[model samples]
Target: MATTSCDVAIVGAGLGGCFLAMLLRRRGQNVVVIEQGPSIPSAGADFLKPPGLRVLARHGLADLVGRHGLRRDHIRYYHDGDPIQDCRFPDGGFLIRPYRELVELIYTCCAMEGVEFWFGAEIGDIAVGGGGVEELTLADGRRLRAGVVVGADGTRSL
Candidate 1:
């Protein structure tokens, strides 16, 4: 059996996982992305709606959003069929961008940067060593080792 090693192991193929994988690879780290799901679709309504926008902002992605997003100047609020509030943003706006496009871009960058990716592979168990995870056992019974493991498996992740 052949075993593979990496400096970073990313679990998940969601937006965050893909982006982080590309970013880390750009920084010259050997990265591996393990995804339970298939690849991100090329066409979808995935965009930085309210929740995603907040997450992006907190991660210092506001500038990126601004550069790659559609911005709106005003936000309208209605309550019971009546206009309640109209807020104006002086320096910010509703940022909109296709989530699939961003993911595709990141995935391409990851590929170009040599971030190894495995799809349809679910992490079954994690072996912890020292201060971080040492290896991950996949559903296919393959053991992969890494210096750092990132659990971007989302909310329900264990």
Candidate 2:
């Protein structure tokens, strides 16, 4: 019944969504992330590759995101039960956390930045025009008007 507005409205609280929200909020944007599920998606890419870690470091989250997660410097490849060449990571290392745990860490950081999360808010209709999304209408009659809309809702997202 109530309409809300944000500088950026992102659908889905996956890795991309949470990371983007944190970035925008840090830059002084009011961000809202809508998720149809109760929390962040349970599964996704498991490794926080070096490039990604660098980006997080710029945001002062390098230690926070990597803390407590496994530091992976090497990985063994296998083919048909036969050991193949082992690949090694360069520089420091990559952070290896389960998909859920990785996302949860960023989600927690987003909360600290005042990013709003609308969990369990199923989306209904999206209005688009001017080569961009105009607004989003949720199933429960809630409308969100965002200056910009981002779809980080994962594969098969609508």
Best by lDDT: 2
User: Which predicted model would earn the best TM-score?
Assistant: 2
Task: Give all TM-scores, in the order shown.
Answer: 0.74, 0.92
Instruction: Provide the overall lDDT of each model, using Cα atoms, as 2-decimal numbers.
Output: 0.76, 0.90
lDDT tens digits, residue span 1-158, model 2: 77899999999899999999988998999999999998889978888878989998988888887888899888888999999888788998788988898788889989998999999999899998998888899999999999998889877688
In model 2, which runs have C-alpha deviations exceeding 4 angstroms?
A: none
lDDT score at residue 113, model 2, on the 0-100 scale: 89
**Which residue pairs collide in model 1, if any?**
46-99
